[model samples]
Target: MKGFSAFLGKEVKEQLRNYKFLILGIVFAIVGLLSPLSSKFLPVLLESLVDDNITILLEDPTYIDSWIQFFSNTNQISIIVLLLLFSPILSKEYEKGSLVHMVTKGLSRQSIVLAKGTLLFFCWTVAYWMSGLITWGYTHYYFSDSTAEGLFLPLFSLYSFGLLLLAVLLLGAVLFNSAFVPLLTVGGFVIVSFLADIVPVIHEWNPLQLATRNTEILVLQEGDRLLAQAMGVSYFICIGLVILSIVIFRRKNIA
Candidate 1:
């Protein structure tokens, strides 16, 4: 924990100067706004595009529809951008030998790992909830019947899932010096998890459901135990990865 706070402050300031926060804020804000708006209007846009001779009947959009878009956009657009933006988090430091300089100047390896991990988690939490809250408010305004009684668990599951991804990302960044390799590491993780889900007994433990099954949970309110179990597993894995990264990083050669 030595110099953890100072390094975290440095990380925050660097992100600010680099416009990472601004870019993420804008991207998530747009993702938030688009959720409800697209749910409400995309049907009309599609219908209007059809020729007069074509008759298309689309179901009236609901708050559920809005959430569908929310999860979809967050998974497809927001998460992708977030990963790309931060994939080089540790790898770039490795490339520049900046961390070596800091290490030589009395910054502990533990502090660096903990500080960067904290930064990643903090950024993900803020941006993710910002998008969630925005969609929640707008969806309610547009559809008063949008009573998301079970929204919290689903949303929390998604948030927890992001933490899992970040943990993997941090480990990836530590193990690989190239930015793209970390991205591929995340991809490989998802692929393996996805494949593992094909086994019925393993599905309950799959963290991928946290990202993919939010809407189903919101609507039916089922799978509470499943999500809880998955969250527990994810937390355990996340902690392990961070620890592993710290160990690997401490022994890594930066010269």
Candidate 2:
């Protein structure tokens, strides 16, 4: 962990130089705006697009609808883009043999993992919150007659899931030297989680609950109980992944 602060600062500088912040901010901001706008207008657009004889009775869009769109967009759009964006973080360096100079210069492999992990979480937290805040503001403007009760936990659950993803991505980056390998690692992890959730007994402790149960969390339903448990598991697994990644990277042949 020596020089962790310096390494993290370097990571931030590189990200800024590459316009990573600009790209992430703009993308998440657009996604946030789209959530409320699409939720409010999609029903109207559908009605207009349908055939005149077609009788499609859709419910009026509400704050709940906007929030639903928010979560969906965050998951399907924002998170996917995020994983793709950072998928090459470590693996690309391996391909370039760029990390060898740093390692030869007394940089700890653990520092690389720690710094990159910190950078990943920091970027995700900021970008995700920006998106959520934007969605919240517009959702309120469009659905003025809405309650703010029970919002924090549900939103937090989604953020926690993003952390879980970064951890898996970090481990993938350490274990493999290809950018695509990390994505496949994350994909495999998600697929297994989704499959495991099919069992009622397993669903209670499954970390995927944090990502999939936002509406349930908002309602203080049985899922609320399960979400809390899942968040704990998610963090536990995230830590384990970080540790495992560091251990693997320390021994990995990055060249």
Candidate 3:
């Protein structure tokens, strides 16, 4: 526990020094602010773009629309930024020979992986929640009837999916020594997951649904069962990936 705490502290300090936290915070806050602002003004903006003679039939923006924008922005843009930021988790250390020194100094490989994963997860949670809170506040102010059923379940499911992605990236880092390799690994996984979604039988259990179907859950209270299943699968997959990373890192020959 002591070793894990020490390494976790080191990871946090490193992230702070690199300005990762600052970048993520700014990006997510902007996303939060934009979600509601765009939903509210998009109709007017579109109308302005058109000539006065043209009639643009658009529905009034609601809190649901704001939430849709929020999830879409977070699922696509925020997640990409997060993946890019942390893609080099283990590879950078390998390149710099930092892990070699730590291993030689009596740090266990499992502790290293666990600490880094925990720190990254913590940062992701904080950034995500900050954005969520901002979005909620703006959404309420804009639309007084902004209540959505089963909101927390969908949000948490999306968060779990993020953790699953991070774990997979970590495993990829352990398997390959290049910074780009882990990113490619994650990309390939996403592609395969998308392809898998084409099959009807797989929809209920697909982890990707956690990212894609959040709006449905928020709007209709639909997919509650699917959300639960996807969350379960995602968390288990995250744990499995972390364990696999530890096993592989232990056997890896560090030069």
- Identify the leading candidate in terms of lDDT: 1
The TM-score measured for candidate 1 stands at 0.96
C-alpha lDDT of residue 216 in model 1: 92
State the C-alpha lDDT per candidate: 0.90, 0.88, 0.87
lDDT string, candidate 2, 225-249, tens digits: 6777888899999999999998888
Instruction: Identify the runs in model 2 with alpha carbons over 4 angstroms from their true place.
Output: 221-223
- Tens digits of per-residue lDDT for model 3, 128-151: 988988988899899877874667
Model 3 CA deviation exceeding 4 Å by range: none
Candidate 1 has its poorest 10 consecutive residues by lDDT at 221-230
Error of 1 at 101 (Å): 1.6
TM-score order, best first, reads: 1, 3, 2
Tens digit of per-residue lDDT, candidate 1, span 104-207: 89999889988989998998999999999999999999986798787888888888888989999999988888978989999999999999999988998888
Cα lDDT of model 3 overall?
0.87
Error of 3 at 188 (Å): 0.8
Q: Is candidate 2 or candidate 3 better by TM-score?
A: 3
Residue 68 in model 2: lDDT: 86
